[model samples]
Target: MEALNLNVENTSSKKVTKLPPKISPKHKRINVLEEYKKRNDNKVALNLVVVGHVDAGKSTLMGHLLYLLGEVNEKTMKKYERDSSKIGKSSFAYAWILDETGEERARGITMDIAITKFETEHRRFTLLDAPGHRDFIPNMISGAAQADVAILVIDSTTGEFEAGFEANGQTKEHALLVRSLGVQQLVVAINKLDVVSWSQDRFNEIITKLSPFLNQAGFKKDKVIYIPCSGLTGENLLKRSQNILEWYSGPTLFQQIDKFEPPIRLLDKPFRLSVSDFFKGGISGMGGITVAGKIEAGTIQIGDDVLVIPGGEYGVIKGLEANDESSKWAAAGDSILMTLSGLDILQLKVGSILCSVSHPVPVTSYILAQIVVFDIKVPITKGFPVILHRQSLNEPAIITKLVTILDKSTGEIVKKNPRCLPKASSATVEIKLTNRPVPFETYKENKELGRIMLRKGGETIAAGIIINILSYNS
Candidate 1:
């Protein structure tokens, strides 16, 4: 009787209207290069990552610089001073600006990358204050991956310089990693020189010892600039302190930063954006989801249809923000916030790549890469389980094959199918991701998307560049 009643209701003359298939808006592709030409030339954006060994005064130096630059107000600084003094750590007041975490403040260490925006006379800068501790090297690598230039801070205290530059210290490792990641220009800030009474001999000695190692690590002597400054006293940061160094003549730290040449923007390529972070609700209480990351290649505009790789979810760009300012379009190298229309928060995650539906980044499980192994206790062997880091993505992977070991000094093949890749060695190897496919491109195609880092036991073991996509299994 119930089935008959339901059938009667279905058969009752309900004029059922057929709903039309939802047609997504068709977007006309804009000439990104033409758009770029219309922009003002006064502002140049550059991402600068600060790196050095543990307790090298990296955070304090940058934090102090920000304070002096007026990014941090006097009231906030006074508050930090009062709070730090209560704990008998008044010296850490400036460091507290960047090391905002309670644990970080208490321990007096920076454990994660602190990103902030500041402006110079001629350029706008995205400063990445990376951790200097050995345990946080992975975090440092993540920060360095997004930088166009780097600032290597060094402690100038008599014995401290030796402690951080010798074996097991991160100074050498940080230099090699950044250079391998394609950071061409570097500023070496010899910090805390005031501790040694601002002696020129100490400054010269530190420079002489580090210069050879830096050059061997692929830093051009001319491209590297060394500045002696006291982070605690703010000497030679914004301007040279009077009567401190009558013998020396050079630009201040701010001048060096302003001189950094910006990398050529990849505006003509296909649009690709790497999702470094994601959140549920956007700027307003609107239901739109927001994803923050840098545009790796090409350009994206509001209302453009985008394809999220690996998951293959589709979405439309509802809003766009370049460097925290709302905009109609964003081009490569601009760190942006994108409000997406159709994707659920669950469908998106860090390391996801957003690309145009017409031209999307390839998703692959197996890749061929050219790697340079850092100083390690054991050689990297086949089938060795390691953590693979690409941008913000971290996944388990295995070294599938060692194709060939290349000479460190020259590009010639040293040996074919080497049994193991030793420390300070270069090789072309195949890597297999253990979990899911990742968005990747060849190194020659996109530097930002092609770089990869390998870690094991919380230590960075190797750094590499993708040479080819060996397999694309979904």
Candidate 2:
């Protein structure tokens, strides 16, 4: 919940103040206006989620990319130079960027998600670092939710995928969850290529095993891109290398990402912006929900009439900007921020929906969701009450019906009218909420608006891909 104090100034130093030109920092301005122009010219930003089993090198690849992209700050560089011997593993590069905690490094596991933005000449990638351990699967769900693409890291020398097999040998659970979350693009970075001597055999083996799992995870071949890399040695990330992975003719990690495209979505589906965070600036009009979305329809501008439907409230847009660009108006496909004139914080929650009053679908009870269970220490009971996360809102809901649980790997129903659902299963079930007015929909109908994360006892137990909404006759 900590916003980055992102003060890039005061980075002056002694040794860093006089490094060689190549090693010296190349500062770049992050202007929203230019980015908006590019977007208007059809340049879109891509979000890539770096995920794999713990220590499979997710952090390292991120760190390597950041280093190449000149994002590792001067403070971190000094910290590394002063304590290089104390640092462990190549993945520490990315881990440092995200796992900024003693416990995270000590345990060598990513528990929460950290978002970082890195730019290449071809594209800008927003990295979502998801925890690799099974215990932190909910964190993974939360991270993957924002990603348009996923990069699954596989350690070649281990001869198996990162993270061990689930209780039922469903090591592919993360991949399944990624697909279920509506991330359309996939990239498998067979990391530690140096350890395997960049053997095509090992890479092919991993891909061979991955392809069927990708199928089970419901990913298409054209959508999946595989690359061999070494996060430690920094190969095949930003450049076309002459190293052992020459047999691979595919693009560098950057090229693959730069070419990525979010699947076809209905931009005509009406403009909806869900507030994810709020900051009480110096004044009320100055502070509103921090909303993020590529404008779907109509124009959002300063002083525009924006109805805070969830609050039954009304507000005037006092400010409008996207990607830091001073856009007079943000229309369809422009990711921007808009401030409200009036509304109490209570009227909005993390997952509340913000849309045109004409197209209002407020939060409600009795949600019918299609779920994919990634973790199960025990079965999900019929009456299990868990939390649901959407937008910035997280609310409590109970499983009113077990309904039908489908084994996606087999494409068949393993249980009918089951009292409890087992591990790593996909199902379509009726989830009745304790509260009315939770905004949700069938994921198939609208991915941006239709997904929910399931949390229990303050822990994320599962995530549901909403499939249908049933009317209440009350």
Candidate 3:
């Protein structure tokens, strides 16, 4: 399983040309970007991930927001309320919307990501409700990779803030992880502010404390904002409650979400979609397998021939849905559900990259990277074991060689062949995947696919970008 399929023609060594599918008179190739513009009026689409510490009420906050936005029906809300009451957890009625599994309900925790689609006045969103507990950081990383922005929900009740902000709190870790994964904009919702009677002092205190750390995590000051709200009572989510907090007036959380600037789409690049989830049956009676993922580069349309990398299985797109709406084509940054034909059920994997046949992503077992080490108890040495996380893929990898240690600011090598990398150090190292070769691009070629994180013992030890592919599978 660790070897790449060498039987298939190598795009590096051989020019693999893609043959256009024969079309009828009415089925001519349409400009996908122009068509997308015409369908959405002027609304922009983006992915949003919710992150916070355990018991921070992230699920309840998002679930209630969805209900307020009419994404969840009143009858369904009532059912959740009734069921939650029977379990003596009436307070978690809204949380039940996203935590649907019986195990999650019983444990009162979100273990896996729950995805939902909703729209605001000026934007359409694919909301990924990520787990907050430390045990599920890998799942959280998978969710954050697909997000354009993040909502960091912080519990504002007394003692709660300290516990989550200090000493192994996920609030700090989540912020760093999202920034490392390329999420730029962050909305820090000071959740449960009503628990302290909407005190502006408390809100300011939280901001004052978090501002420096967030800046250190690579989030620009202007790009980060704070909003006070009660997820339980639904205050300042859709509309600001009257006479609730006379000292402050600001946009609701929904309004702030709309203001987030969507990043530039990679429409001109070769088509690449990282597979997140797939199933056997197709949508709308289409007899093919459905694959779900965010398009990382270029554009994909019906009838486009795509090759799944690492396995080299071929498929043709038969149907597609973007942001929960049926569409003819989808571009980069759109969370898509695509139905594919001419593929084996066993060939497709969660981490496989689906790309244009002619311009396929390179499959490599070894890569050179520049990584920034995180705060850790022990230093990272050669042969260090780590689980390399890229998108949804987690492979066992090791630091085979430590090339050089670089100045954190200048990128100049301070020392060559250092003994070990200490905490907060920046270094260039060579990593080899112990599991199997995976489809990946250099950071210069594709930002989404290039960024990676190394986790060891349930902690994120370092984050880096693929600098170069040392060797490609022939």
Candidate 4:
């Protein structure tokens, strides 16, 4: 294992200004905070993840919205329509705009996260359309980790909503997952109401049934908004169905999107970017590998030197792109594609963290965490095998020790050395990553990097935050 190198010569408290001779001449010191502020004034950046159970029409809804906003032109949309019709999936025309893969189109379900960029009147959004099937929960969790706010789409047709919201469904799991990952604002879009003749009662009934569960899942009532719409007809999406549904006078889906407040960013902290996806850029005529992720903290610009943790590889930022436009710099809360130079691409992995060379995140194999057990069929016992998920990485782990059960509200100890952890319980436990050391931080240090999810047998058993690093490679 490679240890973090802290003796790299610059010995400064701030970001290092000295660059290697391999770096371009543009590598110089400037106040990145001032530049970020100027760009932020025009349009606040927000990451929006659309999640729900399978067949909720998530892709179609967002695809139509993109077309309405002119992100998808008529010429391209017409091709999708004609192709979908020939394949006997005419209703999936709009969905094809985001679900571009032949596999996804053939199966008629989104298998992975499809990312696209669009702008509202007051906000610029990087839309993450996550997979909704139970088998793709890991993919959904990756998308949710980067989202600042979420849209929970539900099928409002008679028996559809009940099937998704009841009996161990993805609807409940997705809602809990996003809230566990620290998403506060939610928009519950009640879709397919047009199938039921645009009935207002159906919309209210669905909301009434879902409110208590969402509240239990950690979403506040005041922060959750409900809207009624038809993804197929595009009614109540960008415009109101005034003549048919006279009951709803609330804002449309697009209006509610603009109303979501952007979360506070850690602009002055040390730079950190979690790697989600990477590919060879030389295929596109670019020279190096391109990495994509949302900046979790601080600011990074072209020519900045970054250290990839757990492997101790160094790379220089050769270029940056945000919202499909070339940018010189990007701050926290912006999802960007970074082209890196002077580093071997093999060292970059999905779970790797790129940080300031002088101040890198810790690499830990053991941690003490406070976890809340979710609704599960079986109790979690000592040495229980599980998959630990954090950000974009999931690795095999075990509950090495069951320390004590704590009160969820007061944080006071209820029992010491509990034999087993039951559903809906909170406890402090020791976990060991069996695979390798991973980049981690305490919740007090950074909220985004500290959250973890535990899953077993295709179901999420618990979610928690790391409180202490028991053992690490430094």
Highest lDDT among the candidates is held by which one? 3
* Regions of candidate 3 where Cα sits further than 4 Å from its true position: 1-27
* Worst-scoring 10-residue span by lDDT in model 1: 1-10
Tens digits of per-residue lDDT, candidate 4, 57-162, equal: 9999999999888999999999999999999999999999899899999999999999988899999898999999999999999999999999999998878888
- Looking at model 1, residue 427 earns an lDDT score of 84
Q: Name model 1 segments beyond 4 Å from true.
A: 1-32
In terms of TM-score, how similar is model 1 to the real structure?
A: 0.92
lDDT of 3 by residue, 47-87 (tens): 99999999899999999999999998999999999999999
Candidate 2 structure quality by residue, lDDT tens digits, 1-474: 001111112211111111111211223324434444657465556667888776687877777777777788777855753543366543364556667677886676778877777765566666778888767776676567666788888777764453343333224666766765667678888888788788898889788877887865567889888988888788988875675667888888877777777544354565566555455541235555445544433445555545444555555556666655655556544445666656565676655555654454544577666677756687888888887776346667788898787766543666788877787667767887776655654554455666676777534566666656664321
**Per-residue lDDT value at 318 in model 2:** 61
> Would you give me the overall lDDT of model 1?
0.83
Instruction: Give me the displacement of residue 374 in model 1, in angstroms.
Output: 1.6
Q: Which pairs of residues have clashing backbones in candidate 1?
A: none
- In model 4, what are the clashing residue pairs, if there are any? none
lDDT of each: 0.83, 0.63, 0.87, 0.87
